[model samples]
Target: MAEVGDDVYREDPTARRLEERVAEITGKEAALFVPSGTMGNQIALLCHTQRGDEVVVGEGAHCAYYESGAGAAWSGVQFEVAGRGGLFTAAELEAVIKAPAYYMPRTRVVALENTHNRAGGVVFPEDEVHAIAQVARAHGLAMHLDGARLWNASVATGRAVAALAAPFDTVSVCFSKGLGAPVGSALCGSAETIAAALRFRKMLGGGMRQIGVLAAAALYALDHHVERLFEDHAAAKVIAAALRDVAGAWVPAPETNLVMVDTPGIPAARFVEAAERRGVRVSAFGPHRTRICTHLDLPREEVLRVAEVLVEALREANAEASAGMGAGTSAGTVG
Candidate 1:
């Protein structure tokens, strides 16, 4: 059913279907499909700003730290970083706008990441989102949301994705991550902005022929894979609780799917390598931090088993998950 034609001409039926579905879900006027979340974000940036304009982003946002400098390289723009966990307040956002002067680069956009990746999957509070959106609007700036893990955010927060996305001028969401699709993301916005993004996409070689195969997979994921994200969140909390008990290790409770574990005495690389040897894998973030993401691939039983395996591995390495200085959190939320 997904046999497709050239998408550059917007002739691919399934691709159009995906775009329509995404627009409906995000409550935007239109949507465009891109090959990846990075492309979706860059395209939004490219369409929203001119050369030398500045985009405000979170301190540890993917656009700031993880996108290979594409914002500066491809968009020909600079960034003004604000806030931790990728959540900045309206005052913080408004304060960063440059004074209107010929020498100053105009602040053209404010970008946000939901279920912020590097921050232990913290969901951006709805109040903060609206407040910041108001600031962006007041400053005559566009807003772009990098909602790559928004499905997880939505499920965890008990909010509709549309509600979370409503305040932004444009929003990008991924189908490949928690949604379980092979590849693809969508950027939703006004028709004008999406039209502009499409040109940028073509300029960046993001146009495709016969992309409906992937679009079909993405559509399937929307129907089948979005509802149970809470299971992953639950699994992450379980692992975090277990990790807090490991000697010399403290883990931040996760809001969504990703867990960040801190090992003060153990090198992160050593811990990751040791865990891998025991068939338990984690992402090394720094010398002392490791990131473990729970997903559909890891079931509840597997999560508990991995926790025990991690404890055992660390015990063998003479490293236990110790109660750190701040381990007595009531919310158990650290990072």
Candidate 2:
């Protein structure tokens, strides 16, 4: 059982241990545990920005695409996408910075996502991150990292987590995602930034009593789950290799645990249904794209089985789409 106390009063021993461990791992002066990744990101925004500020982000960032406009609602900020395909270079970031004027939305922060989600889990290049940080500092801007899958990035690239996080002023990391913890994410930054964020966390209703019960799970994940993420990455590669030869299926080499399949001329829903029927569940990422992820629950043997099932499902869906196209063409010709 975890020792528990009031986190709002800053006395939760388990929560304190998790925060300290995350801070040390990320090379930050302090860390604050929050309820979800969204809240962590939102709190970072609040700490960095005043009302009516602008934040630069890469396309398809989780904070922009998946957070349901929490940045706008909670932080009073708007986003400007710096580059295409969810990863931006320093020059691309510089191009979007607003010129100094009373009439412009003052540029305040640059946020990045590692293992960019909607871009099919590509890892952000380390050198590029350092260059971007240089640009941000020159322009007096702050940096925040949506590092929800940073653990995956670390294992994929063989870089330490602190090295990857060094360029940012604030970093939000999730325990629930690849780490296999059931609940919690943490925002790590300088002691001053985290102190400011604590007030914001309370204002936003994030304060909790006895949060150490949940914090212990996150601690356990850090001890046991971080290194094993490589297994999930290997599983993703297996799936991608299996489907690469299937007709009408375009599978990219996954850099992490996320595998995205593009099924041109066949609806994503069609492929998803086909996979489900064969006992493999996948998400419809777009009209013609399906997303599959390997996680803690899916063992090596199960992943191998999934690879075979996905190949058959892709072929079945493709054939059905071609048959429907032929039927429509014949009907038009007869008429």
Candidate 3:
């Protein structure tokens, strides 16, 4: 592992190196390392806005629905949800900027998630980002990006991560997600913004000492693992194609490493249980939709195995349902 001195005092050489690299990649003046992507994004919000402020975010954004309301609790900022699929047009944002009304909280930040989680990991187009940034600038609102899966977006779209991040005032990127590092996230921004974020990080109990070990892993991933995300994307599309042929299975066209399959006419929990029994693991997202993620840890053989097990599980479920109906029953349980 790379070695560095204590980081709580900001002397860790490896951490500094990683921060500097992240800043260069994002075209930011500075960067700070945080424990997780959520922490990185939340710290940025806390540092950028005061209490009683509002942050505009997509309805399906991780910060809006999945971060356990940290923006509200830690930053004392309210969320103004934009749209169902976590997409907002520039016109939409312009309309939402509050007038000079004392009753409404001022919208201080506009946050977006690239490769939107609930939208089947859809990558937001760069033009949309630029337009929204223009609106944010006109309103004096800072823009932040929850770029946890940004590397995947870059690989899938053939766009540099910096190009996507350039329009935002701050961006949080993760190494543990698609990058396959064990842990670490970097928040990149202007020097003053990062200086303020470092303080908020300390207040949020995110300060660490001698964190070069984790930083080293993150650095390694950024160097060696980013280019291979295209393979994961290809694997996801393969899984989606396989699921499309399975009876009672619905798979959306995948854009990244995530594949969302809808097991219609079959309970998703049962599908997951059956898949696990076959030594393939998957998680149910809703009553019908289940999410399967392809990662560096999961090899191509494992991906194929998952697809085979899903097909078998679906076949068994359909047969069981058919047998039950033939026997004049509603449905039958499969062991």
Q: Model 1 over residues 1-335: C-alpha lDDT tens digits?
A: 78697898899999999999999999999999999999999999988898999999998888777788998998899999877557888888877889999999999999999989888789999999999988888889999999999899899988999999999999999998898899999999999998898998999999999999999999999999999788888988888888788777888778899989877776666667678899987777776777888888997778889988877766654433242222211111112
RMSD of 3: 4.3
Worst 10 residues of 3 by lDDT: 326-335
Residues 207-326, candidate 2, lDDT per residue (tens digit)?
999999999999999999999999999999999999998988889999999999997787777777788899888887777878888899898878878999999998888888988843
Q: What's the lDDT for candidate 3?
A: 0.85
Please write out the lDDT profile of model 3 over residues 1-335, one tens digit for every residue. Answer: 68888999999999999999999998899999999988998998987899999999886788877788898898899988775677888988887788868898989999999988777788988898999999899889999999999998999999999998999889999999898899989999999999999998999899999999999999999999999998899889888898899877878899999888776676666666667788777776666667778888888777787777778876776676556533221221110
TM-scores of the models, in the given order? 0.93, 0.96, 0.93
Off by over 4 Å in 2: 325-335
Better of 2 and 3 by TM-score: 2
Name the regions of candidate 1 deviating beyond 4 angstroms.
Answer: 317-335
Could you give the candidate ranking by lDDT, starting with the highest? 2, 1, 3
> Which of the two, 2 or 3, has more lDDT?
2
The TM-score obtained by model 3 is 0.93
Shift of residue 147 alpha carbon in model 2, Å? 0.3
Error of 1 at 194 (Å): 0.8
| Model 1: lDDT of residue 15 | 94
